[model samples]
Target chain A: MSGVRKLVLLGTGLIGGSFALALKRARLVQHVVGVGRNATNLERALDLNVIDEASHDAAAAVAGADLVLLGTPVGQMGALMQQIAPVLAADCIVTDGGSTKQDVSALFRQHLPRHLSHCVPGHPIAGSDLSGAAAAQYGLFEGRRVVLTPFAETAQNALEQVQTLWQQCGARVYTMTPEQHDGIFAAVSHVPHLLAFAYMNAVLAKVDAQPCLDFAATGFRDFTRIAGSHPEMWRDIAVANREAILADLKACASQLQHVIALVEAGNTEGMEDYFATASRARVAWGQRHK
Target chain B: MSGVRKLVLLGTGLIGGSFALALKRARLVQHVVGVGRNATNLERALDLNVIDEASHDAAAAVAGADLVLLGTPVGQMGALMQQIAPVLAADCIVTDGGSTKQDVSALFRQHLPRHLSHCVPGHPIAGSDLSGAAAAQYGLFEGRRVVLTPFAETAQNALEQVQTLWQQCGARVYTMTPEQHDGIFAAVSHVPHLLAFAYMNAVLAKVDAQPCLDFAATGFRDFTRIAGSHPEMWRDIAVANREAILADLKACASQLQHVIALVEAGNTEGMEDYFATASRARVAWGQRHK
Candidate 1:
């Protein structure tokens, strides 16, 4: 496959900068352009050699680029797509690193309707507590899973190009529909984060919240680690994928209600049974994953 | 302070075996007697040098012992306490390593009424997935917190002796009422565990559970790590600490309900505010603890 002549990153944070670095290391892209509102971050990306050039204007950056990666938060992707639509080349392959696919897919359809054939909405499952261009590294996507959700109008050649690029970055790629991608993420990532936030809030509501926190050990630490995630990013996820997230939250609430009933009735056998099912499945999953 | 002449362990598992090993390393105990129902486990304890002697009979083992540690599940502690009550030495310092203290306090009151002055209930916060005598380590409690709940009738010297021994084992000891210990633990350890179990079960209830599990990444792994805990052990804790666990679980459920409402109403700012509170507090706690 021919390498990208010019690759543009719409937002040069960890995700976009890391992608640029990885592709640069693989020699799959000739020149990289990073576009973001943060001048300091763009300067850091240039200092770190994550991108060859930096630009504040998205439209100008992608004017003649063969590849464009929308690595900003989902909330910012629509305006970015609208800004670059008029200046994009005839076949500039546009993809994104959004956490949610359905929303990004809708944005592609809304702002870049004529460019659907070249747009591939994707999510790279490399979540981290760190951000900014300084957090980017060449191996960030190595061994990570990336899910691509291509709409019906997306060209097969465009999809293959994105997949091959992610492969060059040492990522394992899988393809699914936008709806399937949203639902699966809602189950595994989105809902667990929301649950952790809720659990933390509940602990805070306690009369002895400080003492309770003081006594919290490893179990509490690992369980609520995600509760310390970026508030704006999670708020976007919680609202953007509202229907899927609400369904899982309701299911979790119902499960808690069942647990309460069992505890109230002093049902040792039932409680053991409930816990055993979860423990057994979790243990099996852990062994397999490990 | 003088060392214990002979110490009896009524349950020779991780907690009990680790305590025996720590005391031996400190040269604070002249003799350690491990007693349990499983002959194989007792033999393993002896082979591992975690115990100086092994016995199948708790009553027989405590006949001439100056100290006794009930290092078993809460459900089995009562039976062992009753069995050793008639044989216990007059001034033997009896303590337990149970997770929940209120029930153990009640058991000490009922089974060893005459020995209340010598009884000090303790909980070592060194939880691990591994168990059995082989899993015992020399410094399992080196930097762990050990909470001791000594009743009003407990002799100062007896409590001091237990506290001193734990200090020798390299544990930081804190004293509180049994009720306070249970409530604080329910908020931190017990409820987080129960919440994890409920979350795992909710995931298992999904129609595409396997696919969800396949796609589960780091967040799910950390969030549900405690769900793989021992079922019978957690069941006993849930029942023994029923009132406090139920209250926290209800509060957690209510929090989830509020989150659901925020999502349903598309209240992005409300969601952001709710997440910010938790994220800020958790981040602060992490920094302080680290």
Candidate 2:
């Protein structure tokens, strides 16, 4: 436990609220201030004991805090960072719970240039379709991974503090460069979401789509599960991480083209080998995970 | 209860094994002859009581069978149909559990022209990563959907018998033409498996694939779950349903191209609308399903 006396949470929803609850259970956090745009949500977080107090003004909330966590959408982090810049304590350490890191790193650079060493960029890989402070729970981060991408200017002590906090929240922490993090996540996460969306749109284009969907079984259900993601959030992530996502999508297109040619030419052997490679790899991958 | 005197299963694997177990529990099947190439799997089926007898010869197995189920891969079904043709009795009803119906329909026409009325082509939408006779369960098809694609020459009595057997296994049976079954499944089932294969292959093409796989969470898990499917099985389905699957693949490629254009142009609102279209439809589909 970091023994942090005062901690402020910006955008007290699932991630932030859950963090507060975990640390409170550890007896590490004495006072927590929840800041959010939605007054109803802030009140709920307070009522649910996700925070000791609630405030709409982020800058005012961070006034006497030793630690401040920015848990809003990547799109909203810049404004929040700009708001809390002047009022943050001299030694206050600021970290975030954003999915994408490169843009958040850029935001930190732009908004708090003078507070560079105190700003530690981190992402806790715990997101669900469910949202709101009411969805927060103590064990949300249990056995989950948290990736921290700290810059050269990021103070060693500040990084460790945030790392310790995540550890106390039952998460294993791993550190990587922002570029590597974005590239890896683009291949695995962002690109899959885009493909699922595109696949859903393709099905909707068919004349007999309703019948197709009605007869769809478990495979269709699992493959398109992420296609029902929040549009605004996915759109923001897509636009925010445009370059890496475009590269991933282009790779996917290239592969799809090869597959299309094989199918069009009726190359049974080539198609079999192709499907075999993927299936073997996936089965091997699952075995490793298990 | 059909009280099938002797039911012969051509391939005693997941689908066939489970069906046998379900029928045994229902007391609808008096005896089940499990036929497969693998001796160990046959012994396991017998030990598990999924079948009362085990045999390697398809022709020998069907000699006394009142009901014969061709439960092998679509690629192997034609040969099995040929093997059982000479031995099948005039009153014996023949059905299959192939994923694609048109090819199986063709096999029925080619190998059993004289017995067309007694042949029924069916696809039970129950698939899992687990295989072998040991994975069989009594309730595998309970509350599951079974599509029966009866031909124009199919006898009403034969279709009803097969339908009642599925109902006894606790499945809801649906009737359609073989072409309709192929088209709908091509759009939903076949295409999604191919897409998942393509996506997994794309990730493998990346330089940091293992790292990407390492960091992948729930979204990636569900998205790529079917990628771990049986390679030979999927290849057979893909090639067997090539025409319909090709059309679906083309539509998906077109949708991906459109998404790429939206993303490349950085048209935020356009991208949002595109994502929203897919997200809305998926959510609505899920709601209707629930």
Candidate 3:
């Protein structure tokens, strides 16, 4: 129930900026320090009152902070962790908004072994196509789910504090091992993005791709929505969670092969049942979610 | 252009019902007769003024009709065509809202051989998850594209009538051979639906599928939106456009294999480029279309 005396966001982009703003609005944070290599984005965060101060030096920004959020892409988190480890207060609680968790867990063990108890690796399921500080809003995490993949050495008090912070932001917090979180996300989020990208390439490979795209309608719009995601970020995610994502991708490829065989053989009954199983499940899922 | 004197809908669902409403709004048709196995749905069409009369007999419905629009699953088209062929007027036009065209072209040749000159196969890209007569709306095809695949034997006058009728419904009409229309749709629409179904089945095969589904977010929602489509309808489309759909499915499988190799080798640069190609194109497409 103790408030953060100084909160630091190592990457003041959408996720980081929104978290800082939410905590500030909740009166749970006294001072927010925005740290990023993007000077303009960091300045925007400060101008938008998402942070009380802005700094390019992540190491210096966490010097006196009670809570520090590593909100950058997972690929950038390791170096930031190493830089801040030397300056971090002994009692400071560390958390992240990374999409993947196992790699971040490894980074925690490798760079901040002594601070494992203070590190709470989290993934807030609140991503949008928009990014950077300007995309930050006051309620980005409202009614969203935040998953914490806390390692074995994570302190109970640190975990509770991180959970409470997310709950204060109107996010429902769930805890799982880094492995479970990675596998689940690989199946649901990462695999779908990869398939969408693959499907887009399939269309592009066509000789009449331009005309086909011109004639594409609403169905194509929804199917390829994720294919339009940020490439660098997705590439990093695919590689970071390589094993789990690879497994899911292979599963998808195998399913696709089966579909190809059914279509090639003109197996109407089999194809119909196959399509029906997935179709029925998807409709059920949509209704349940609605 | 002369309007339809007595328009008959062979299957008064979304497509048929909507066309009737649009024609009624444009005052292009004198009377609209709705025909379907579902008496309740036909009654709804009449109640909504989507039709002036309801009939369960396809042959009886087409007896005095100057224009008969078959708007049911492609699988049901053959039976309805056979039923109405005996009663169709010599000068009457036969059209359809089937998604696939090649099979309907074949059906026109097989069951309604004498009426081939009057048969105008069309595909209105005005699909929605909601079907039934109650889902009919006058603006369903407003600004949408409707493709008409007229056979070699299709009369020029009949073609013009169908084209003019669609234009009056606020749809831009394009004419192509059934082969060309099937190829384009297989690449864009049919293949994507199959891929989404495959992706859904892949997720279902995972050990922690329930948890994966539970954690699925917006990316998953948009990616699988097409997977929730009508199973029987897609099955008919897949089987009807078997050759083209098969070719596209194999093309997609090949693309998936390439992606697997890229990820399996941890080819970050290749994967990034692959994703960037799709992302850039999709964004450009979104901008251009907007």
TM-scores, each model vs. reference: 0.94, 0.96, 0.95
List model 1 lDDT by residue over B1-290, tens digit each.
87998999988899989999999988999999999888899899999999989988999999889999999889999999999999888899899999999999999999999999999999999877567898899999988899999989999999999999999999999999999999999999999999999999999999999999998988899999999988988999999999999999999989999999999999999999999999999999899777
Off by over 4 Å in 2: none
lDDT, residue B107, candidate 3: 92
Candidate maximizing TM-score: 2
Best by DockQ: 1
How many backbone clashes can be found in candidate 2?
0
Which of candidates 1 and 2 is the stronger one according to lDDT? 1
Per-residue lDDT of A1-290 in model 3, one digit per residue for the tens?
Answer: 98899999988888999998899899999999999888888788878999889998988888889999998888899999999989999999999999999899999999999999999999999877667899899988988899998878899999999999999999999999988999999999998888888889889989999989999998888888888888888988988999998888889989988998887787889988999899989998898776
Compare candidates 2 and 3 on lDDT and give the better one. Answer: 3
Which stretches of candidate 1 lie above 4 Å from their native place?
A1-5, A24-31, A43-49, B43-47
For residue A228, what is the lDDT in candidate 2?
Answer: 88
Q: What fraction of native interface contacts does model 1 preserve? A: 0.88
TM-score of chain A of each: 0.95, 0.94, 0.96
lDDT of 2 by residue, B116-163 (tens): 999999999998766789888889998889999998898999999999
Go through the candidates in order and give each one's DockQ. 0.84, 0.80, 0.81
Q: What order do you get sorting by lDDT, best first?
A: 1, 3, 2
